[model samples]
Target: MVKEYYDPEVKYMLWDDFQIRHIDDLKLKVKGYSDDECKEFDTTEDILQFYPNFKDFIEQFFAEEELVNSSTRLNYLSNYADTKTYSVVATEQLTGRLHVNENLFKPSPKVMEVLHNATYEDVYLYDLTREDELAVEISKREEISTDHILIHSGSSDVIKTVMSLVLNKGDTVLISAPSWNYYKSIVELKMAKAEYYDVVPGKNSYEFDVSGLMSKARAVSPRIIIITTPHNPTGAVISASDLETIIKENPSSLVIVDEAYLGFSEQKFDVRHLLAAYSNVVFSRTFSKLYGLAGIRVGYGLCAPMAKQVFRLDVNPFRVNNISRKMAVAALRDEKYYKGLLKDITESRNFFINEMNSISGVKAFDSAANFVFIHFSENTDVQALKDYLAQNGYLVRLWTEGSRLAMRVTLDRKETMEKVVALMKEFLEK
Candidate 1:
């Protein structure tokens, strides 16, 4: 008795239904779907009743925007942060960047020189020779064999390579809740399951739920378990003792320790030794954080020799571009410069935490990474505070994962940190 149009949720409308269709932004138009024949197509069952090719029709009618939005909804970075360039205190990124250090740390001079002086042969080159050199440099720095390292686009690529090599449909990978969302995204993309353990806040700071993690690993018998040290958002570093326990307990599982921020930690642990000792352990590192080379997009993984061979096979040929490979080698060679950068960040981290903790309703966690994790009291309107910060040209990560309401303030130069402290003090006073 009532006419029904196909809903965006249930019954996907076909493009052929519309004689002329147009999509502006997220809206869609279809001509045939507007007619009487498609009026009753409210559900999948309804579509099947009239259209014999229900599945094919739905596939043909699927919206790309809707599919991408739905797939990446939970993994959205801007949900908890902003990237407004107008902000005076741009603390949203945990990258090793400074307002004054623009392009200073990047090996742009060498890159430009090479490009400018290059012959036509260099421009059209499809060689992996530079990448091999990069692998050797990284191997020397990481104390791993060159065979155990594969140069890739970034750390995420390394994760994908490993998962591709080992994971199959119905396999599981263990991750921590509120961990890097990419792990779950990639695992799900592979048609595998992701089992999460919790990272609970500790008296000192955020610590992994080792007992819970081990239990979950035992239950899932996951093919992989990802552990991030100097962890993202929380800035927590897993102790060597805890790491040992997890590695020993999960003998059957491959443990990937993502040490992306390890260089910025107060006490750095040499995880390279683990590669020699354990076949199942792999350490992932990136130049984006400590080396101030986020734009160059270079990262690598250290695994046992056999697993590295599998990674080399799984990764695409010449995955790291020639320029990126050269820059990575340069960054590794300029250790003194990056180490100075680390020292500055460590100091800023300490200062920011101290100043933040001085506020009446705020508690800043002691961070081993380049950012400070701050929690506001129940009485404080954190969202309103974040708005105030944004309005006043400050951008920081406002995290509301779980029941916790906190802000992740990236360590900046002293002048910027002072401005951030003054801004928070003003906001609190108001």
Candidate 2:
């Protein structure tokens, strides 16, 4: 090689030889060959002669890489990796437990029947009419036109699609402090900026700082504003009058109202008036919370005609499959069952709040939604209490902001709520 490494007529042959030798070494390593055995291989063909199965592995590996990396977006996006060992252990310990913090419960028997009776065509076919069918059902329920409704896989998908369509680099999105985390992630993904408005602690529960939000909106003139009614963790709701005021003031900005938890609230307001009044408003809802179909991922939005036209361009025609559509429709039709469930949830929520407030060091806030937010005093052993709850087949969401500690427990069956409250009482007595 030192004497004739760069012959002009044999240059191509030399390059080919080098590549084959390197590939043979890689194959040997992949086959768990020792360095001594690898030294015996001079070419890919020679390695294949020793281990025939090695060729299939190398070919499949390269094919998978070629397929995955073919997308241009992958070059800039971060690659996902498995969780660390300790994180995995913690997750395993909490698996299959009562996840009260999710605000989830079993679906109606009618909805379960539809799922169980799914036909072969329902699963195998393309379901071209599923989205339109669901839209019609939603339109009838929401009192909006089918043309103004757009069905999506979930409310999160609605957010992602709308953000992708509207946001540009450096655009501003106004969000409330301690809003849904998905909003923050989606804003960052679109390379946009997020501006915050505070939700302060009121006399009863957390509430939106309307004047503060309006003041900021006037200053930033954000491209989009997200308002989550019966907002998560705190269960604060924005009044319809206040909502209209915000929309009227921010005439140019697109306003998104997230009503995912609205079904559980005692005070119900029709959003059709706002939708008819403003072309810049969109109300997004999901079948996850009250309907108990979170796993199926069915969500829809009521948009103004102008907004609907823009959204349809990017939304997939077949994004929601046949089975999901059927289940959502079934859930919507069985309103009586849901109403009964809501009554139970409301009762359980009131009981939990009243009981938790009776505890000396704990303060449970009034919630319009199906979950209660309980704040622990500074001296209380919050971590020990959480561990005690976890040990007794219950898992809740713990919220920490600076030195403040709170637990957000979803309203479960009356019996389960009674048991959890008793456990908390036992823990605090020590």
Q: List the candidates' TM-scores in order.
A: 0.73, 0.77
Whole-model lDDT per candidate: 0.70, 0.77
Tens-digit lDDT track of model 1 for 101-220: 222233324444545565665457776454388887876766767878867787877877888788887899998876766687677666788899888788768888889998898788
Model 2 C-alpha lDDT versus the unseen true structure: 0.77
**Candidate 2 runs further than 4 Å off:** 1-104
Error of 2 at 118 (Å): 1.5
Error of 2 at 31 (Å): 49
Clashes counted in candidate 2 amount to 0
Candidate that scores best on lDDT? 2
Which tens-of-lDDT digit does each residue in 1-430 have in candidate 2?
Answer: 4464665544434332333335545342212333333333434555797789998987898688767878753544443211111111123232323433444557789998997899999988886653367888888877878888888998878877888798887899999887666787777777788999988778779989999999999999899999988887788998888888999999989988888887887766567888777888888888888898888988988887777788878888565888898999999999889898888888888888999989998889888887888888776766567656765567666665444657788788778889999999998887
